[model samples]
Target: MSFRRVIIGLLCLAGLAVVLDFGAAAYSEYRVSRLLRDGSDLGADPEVTFHGFPFVAQALDGQFRDIDIRARAVRPDIPGEILVEAGLIGVHAPLGDLVDGNVRKVPVDEVHALMRIEPVELGRLFKIPDLQVFGPPADKSDGSGGSGGTGVTTSGPIILTGTVSLTSDTNPVPGTSDSGKPVSVLADLRLDADGQIQIVATDIYYGDEATPAAMVPEVNRELVLAKFTRTIDTRDLPFGVRPMKVEASGGQIVVEGVGKNVTIDLDRLQQP
Candidate 1:
């Protein structure tokens, strides 16, 4: 072939390659938006959006937008498997997938709200936001939430070990002196497949207090501590069922992770 003809052919191929690349990216973006929108519809809510992505979703009943989340590696006084960042948003969700008989949902907004509060929020204080969960919510009957037999998988048994250095935004108590030092909190958390969470240790240091201090004083200090560790066990309990019983004594914390005791009523999902 003539040199000129060969050159012209090569240029045509390059142009086609460019078009294909852009086409592939557009397709990927379309697929992601569709999946997110489908998730929102299943949850019975508005829309879902993640930063530059155009689609919006109802993480729960709450609304969120311009969310930019990511996982990264860094060094300093921090150690983490990932770090997530987002613009102004409301109610992201805790990290477990929900499994209820034939139904499963993420409750992303619920998780977000939980993450914003105490103990859970402590992970962010360290700049190491390793807390994350993957996979779509699966049904317990389909048999995919956790291991084979226990029957609870919406909230798997998750164990989190981390250190938190936190400075509260709350005003100082009327009678207490301010140390002006960030407190260090050591935490170990567990959540069963049935959506129950148990907290083993959430030890914190505040001035002279040796044991962990209560985030809320109106609550029984011991119970408050136990609740953070215990109530999580009920987080994924049937939305209407009473939580499994508990007995607390001494300083030790014990809990039964969600098991066959939990039941899911998929019939509640009615179409309007």
Candidate 2:
């Protein structure tokens, strides 16, 4: 009987400790979130989470295995609202400083940030008020409309459909009703050696990507598809990380990068 009672007591204590640890972790997240939001251009409070079990042990050691922070509408004066997601590995934050309510400096071993732009936002930036991105159709698809054919893969060249204005009247694009007409462009998104995201169009269709789409003449293609091609600078990437790769996924443009042995101060945290 005494043995069972002792075992029950120890189990209760363990459960209580787990509860307290979670509570402490939540409080820690709140503190870090507040600090991240302060002295920065973060339009909203960052969603912070720590990975690995035994949060209390990691907290006491002042080292976290991995941590993630997410925020929306980061920075101001950009073309549109952007979502930023940052993942830090081997994060070092002294427990004393954290408890003292003033974490002077957080040195992270590795950092990766993802900047996502929705299709609508991309359209706004490119001056195409109605832009859409979709994966290329499978072998069975005819590539008439954006996602018009089924069996779309998650990766690879995306079809961009929008109204583009043709400046060069050198040669007329087929089925053009106005200077600005609905067009579908099959473009490949690739990272250039010069640190730029280049959208190179392979084929362009007139009168929307519908049944029996009309292909633009190659001679006048440059004039009609000029706006469809673009070179984007990687300087505006979050956390000052070099733009590593870009892809169109789930109807959004995602630019991801990684940094090593980085320090996160208040100022550094604010601008991203």
| Cα TM-score per model | 0.30, 0.79
Question: lDDT tens digits, residues 1-272, model 1?
Answer: 69999999999997886676555434533443344324323332212234432222232323334332221212122232212111224323321111111233322221111111222232443232432211112236765553322121223322222222233467542112243222222334444456454444354323221222334333223422232233332332222233333222111122221222223222211111
TM-score of 2: 0.79
lDDT of 2 by residue, 56-143 (tens): 8998888999988887754443476788778989988876576454765678899897887777777877777777776664344555
Query: Candidate 2: which pairs clash?
Result: 144-209
lDDT of 1: 0.30
lDDT per model vs. reference = 0.30, 0.70
What shift in Å separates residue 32 of candidate 1 from its native position after superposition?
4.7
The whole-model C-alpha lDDT of candidate 2 against the native structure comes to 0.70
lDDT of 2 at 156: 58
What 10-residue stretch in candidate 1 is worst by lDDT?
108-117
